[model samples]
Target: MSSFAALRRAHADARFKCIFLRPTLASQRLGCPVSPFSCRLNSSTSESHVSDAPTEETPIVASEKTVPSGDDTLFHKALTPSGRRDLADRIIQDGKELHKLNVELKNLQRFARSTELLVKGSPWKVAKHWFATPFKEDVTLDNGVIRVGSQTVPNIWLRDNCQCNSCMHQETRQRLLDTFSIPEDISIKTAAEFRTAIEVTWSDGHQSTYDKDLLREAGANSEKKAVIRQGQVDIHLWNASIAESKPQLNWEPESRPHEKRVDKFIQGVLQRIRRFGFCYVNRMKATPEATEKLLRRIAFIRETHYGGFYDFTADLASKDTAYTNIALGAHTDNTYFSDPAGLQAFHLLSHTDGKGGASLLVDGFKAAEELLHSDKEAYHILATVHVHGHASGNDGISIQPYKGFPVLEHDAETGALLRVRWNPSDRAAVELPLEEVGKWYAAARKFDAILKRKENEYWEQLQPGTLLIFDNWRVLHGRSAFTGKRRICGGYINRDDWISKYKMLHFGKEDVLKNLAAG
Candidate 1:
């Protein structure tokens, strides 16, 4: 009973003001006196109705037609309990609806200056003064969503990101609330704009005041997140022009350039690979472990059936073509993988013994771009047609058919080349419609011709004490048949792992990685 009396007083105080001060009356608009039980009298000498309420006072029983308020529902035994909830629920359902009744009451509107305008049900100073700049359209809210403009932000998302004292630690800027505690279908009770922020009182009575700048940034971040989920790779398109000024980073690994300077140099190399898809490291460590150590600088060596790392020599009778004394054609490795290795590093341990092992570099992305501009039909056909592959002499005992991909992979929405898979040696069988298979072969031929163009091919005689690393997704690698014993050591790195290392190296954090994915 005492609690109920206290709540009534709080509610009354919230809706009314002291008339002794000559303050405006909200009931004036209704042309009636405000219920003394619901409104506070304005006077320091006047006693409040709540303090006067006694436990022995006769209970004012409500009629069936009378709706129960938040405080009204609390006097169960005294006034006959009814089906109702607390104040929080009432505010969400019908209290001061912005679209109905007085828009001022619904929104955080300007205070009334004229006393004549003050009336019952008028948007008087409810609790505190609020300066709000509202949106144009009527706000729409749902479970985990608040549609503001073109974007719909998740309620749970917004609540979790609340920068309030209860939600986050001020000094650390670390979240304090448990994300899982938020209901999956949580809804917004009321939404209004402030001069610099938007105030949202949730159905659960949790209030979130987000800055306007924060909401705008959130909308942008939401769109960027969606884009990242679709395609996490960025690329640079080029042709023979890539050959004119190769994206080269000539740094000696053994020299151990000053730490800060070396870090910048490493970052530059990574940037080159990110932009041009390949980079050359001149005067690098010349050893069997050179390529392996270099991979650690970026990420762990991608361990496939090839074990960890390898030394390519003129082992004539070896099962793998790379090991034999044969000319390898222009191709990206790991066509057999669904997500192939992204970075490939080659260190010339001993190239003097070799005769014609000059590395042939061709940009598959460059070829695809050319084909796309000159022949859109060919590009589309190649991009759509899927080709199967198999790793014949892999270390794995069980021979499982590797997942396949089209010769050219493009984003359906942006028509951007996402990945390229071309390996004649690893090609398995063509499993496609008869009509489509012929078209695929023709498209592949045209793309291959572009790759084979002399202007597009950048031949570099990889010398000892030099390390060459290229993007397996963009630049195709090949080697001319060699005579003498050539010893080349290299390794493959997972695409995602390399990207992760690159992002961390350049940005020193993961938050900015999404921006790098865009062209």
Candidate 2:
């Protein structure tokens, strides 16, 4: 039997005497009858009798009869010297047993709650004894699989994920034990389940305790695991109509230590950028240093060939068209990078003597989705064709991915579109077979046309003190032709870093690992 069940059984068999309290003089004045402390204590399951006036030695049998008020004689039933001593001894012994029973019950409840939450998404239905101490009959080991409660897990995976302090650094959450050191033919010597966790002893003499929840999650499918890691942020794909109600927030300078006012504002900025692929932070100081400080709140400025936290005018300092007074088509930045920048921030510090430098944004993911439904073949070609992109405009700055990537990239496991790498200006020569060349160009042009469509573009004349941050993977950015100087300041944030900040803020630090591990 489980320890909790045993404790309950023992408590049920014990013959304990409980002293009942009747209404005192004070309670009588308040018009109260029997006090709540007046509880019947049954020494045995069988019914018994209680005399009109019983002595302490006479068992305090269960009775519903209420003693008349002011009957002092019945209230203070005299106890013999020997009876008083016996009652006191039994009271002390039963109190200790009762405490033990309560402790056991509390532990059992905690185990049940934890186990339920952990195995919530499991395919197998949990049996009643799921929280009990697992025995030989409850578990099985065969063909390198350990089956417990109808759920099977690989023996190697279970051994590698040992949560013992010797195997894993508790504070750092890093694996101290070498995974390869584990035996390839590892076997379980013994396995036992408790209310909240499972204990396994390996044939190699290493022991580990695995939480039931972690086990279920590790055994889950790929798509469910991805959801855990990415969280449930609703992505709102936008078109030109988004201009009527843009995702934006107002920035106010922090005036005091640990000020709570800016907490909501910062969270608002992150949520907007995450959901809509971009957000604008208005009413900030129009300076390079100020813009850098704001970007640092999300993550450190990511340095590139151009610079870290850059501030520039139309001076061609980087030998790129972006540094010229010309209109650029909608395209994602850093297509040449293997792991392109995740987020890009832009703050038009000043645009004096400029007529039309309206910033343009196109939702690449939305456009890709449209292509997938409207022209599946075109979408497939774009997703499959590996496009070579490069940045060789500046001296000694030829940059390209080691392996070319698709213009429309999707996650291999989930088959969900993840990134868009489209920058015609920076694309390298087509390296495809002549027969496929025509098809590739046709598909590319079709996607480009979708991006440049009037209904797909959201344009705004960015003003000084209005900062914009966008996801470079999902949003294609461009600028209209301008007349004179148009000063801008911004920088890139690495994909992993910005996403880390978002996950940390969205799901607290404690849960970030739980989700990431599942994925």
Candidate 3:
């Protein structure tokens, strides 16, 4: 017989003995006792007594019986006395406990699964991973999808893709491409897809893959569209022509010949002014005569400082002069004037006497552009808010006016930016409702902080005879205080005169004269 079968037979024998064997000392100790009638087993041998006694017709009674056990009985023996009555009760309780534990375990597992799914499904998690990855190397593009870093973007922008040479290289002179009608059957295959890498498939059966870093460097989203026009004069030639025609001032000897050299130099300076909003004329000796001549040659000059022709002058030797102060913060000149100066000319007549007097120029336009791109809502708030500038010092000149000019304005025709107005302390209370005041303050503060950064500052020392002219409306000028003596001559040319001069030199003599008459 098999081992399992032999073990089963032994257990059965033990159960039979416990149920029907004679009452022994060991059986009583185990809490099990043999029945009295069961122990009398010689029925056939004692048949005569049984028949005579049975003939008496003794009545058989069926009554529930209990077996008694002492307090010292073992747990197993007490549980299974003779019949399976108490053992069945213990089994039912154990089965109920096991079922309750199984249910609890299932509930815990379900909760864990839900939590895992929630974290995996969050968009914030996806974005965080995308930004943290190194994105400057290569961009991955396959078929129609573009992958920037870890982000997989859809191909819906295919129609907007600009690959023409005119759009790609702005400085190049190329024929503009003719516009074509889009095909009606064009359809995108997928909205977005992400894998170990991106795959893009075009409808024309063309496929492409690009490294994610390279795609980012290509500036896919930041690329701008510009219209290319033919028959336009080259910028260099145009500048040269303007310089050749420019008038020369008499204060300083022509460092170059009046006809050939001065015209070329002036043209170069004007080009720089137009392109950068400011430019420097160097090599002229620093003197009051030279500064005055330079200012007059440009156009009529504005006298600042309460009807004073030399409204602003830097005299380092004279402590009484306003120009000797070293700690001048960034500000636009003539805040008190009814019409603020449009252009400012500063001629450093002498710099050898000063130690720390360095000129600092900031491109307010660039700062404003950064603000617009990073926080558009803030840019809008600052742009729409009205600010009042009042200057009340020395001779008591106070002028209040309202202007809707933005801190940053774009040229309507060329789309070039024109930066204007950056004076935080002079900013008047905004006309916005009380509810929006907090938001306005926050935005203005952010803009000012960006402008104050050193990265935005262009530092230079004004050498003697160096005349620096800048668009006063768009450029903010400041200086660092020095201990030594320094002298400078400052003045302004009205916006009308400057524009008239530009048009006269570029557009035509008639247009220039008409604009001058209109002004």
Best by lDDT: 2
Tens digit of per-residue lDDT, candidate 3, span 282-397: 66766666666655665778765544335244543322224556566666765444467777888767655548877877766556666766776676566556666655544555
Model 1, residue pairs in steric clash:
18-42, 19-42, 26-119, 26-120, 27-119, 27-120, 28-119, 29-119, 144-155
CA lDDT of 333 in candidate 1?
A: 86
Query: Which one wins on TM-score?
Result: 2
Superposed by TM-score, candidate 2 places the C-alpha of residue 415 at a distance from the truth, in angstroms, of 0.9
Q: Between 1 and 2, whose lDDT is larger?
A: 2
Model 3 worst lDDT run, 10 consecutive residues: 223-232
Off by over 4 Å in 2: 1-151, 257-264
- Residue-wise C-alpha lDDT for candidate 2, range 1-519, written one tens digit per residue: 533233333333332211211122112222222121122322222222222433334544434454434553432331233433343444446556544554455445545543442444211111112322222224444453566557777778788778778987877778888999999989888877677677888999988887766666665554455543644355678899999999998888545425445555666787788778999998888999888988898888888888899889888678988888889989999988898999999999887875899999999988987786677667767877688889998788899888889898865554555789999999985656676589889988889888988999999999999999999989999989999788999999988887777777766777666543334
TM-scores of the candidates are: 0.62, 0.70, 0.47
Poorest 10 consecutive residues by lDDT, candidate 2: 17-26
Per-candidate local distance difference test: 0.62, 0.69, 0.49
Alpha carbon deviation, residue 331, candidate 1 (Å)? 0.4
Candidates sorted on lDDT, descending: 2, 1, 3
**Error in Å for residue 465 of model 2:** 1.2
Ranking by TM-score: 2, 1, 3
| Model 3 residue-pair collision total | 27
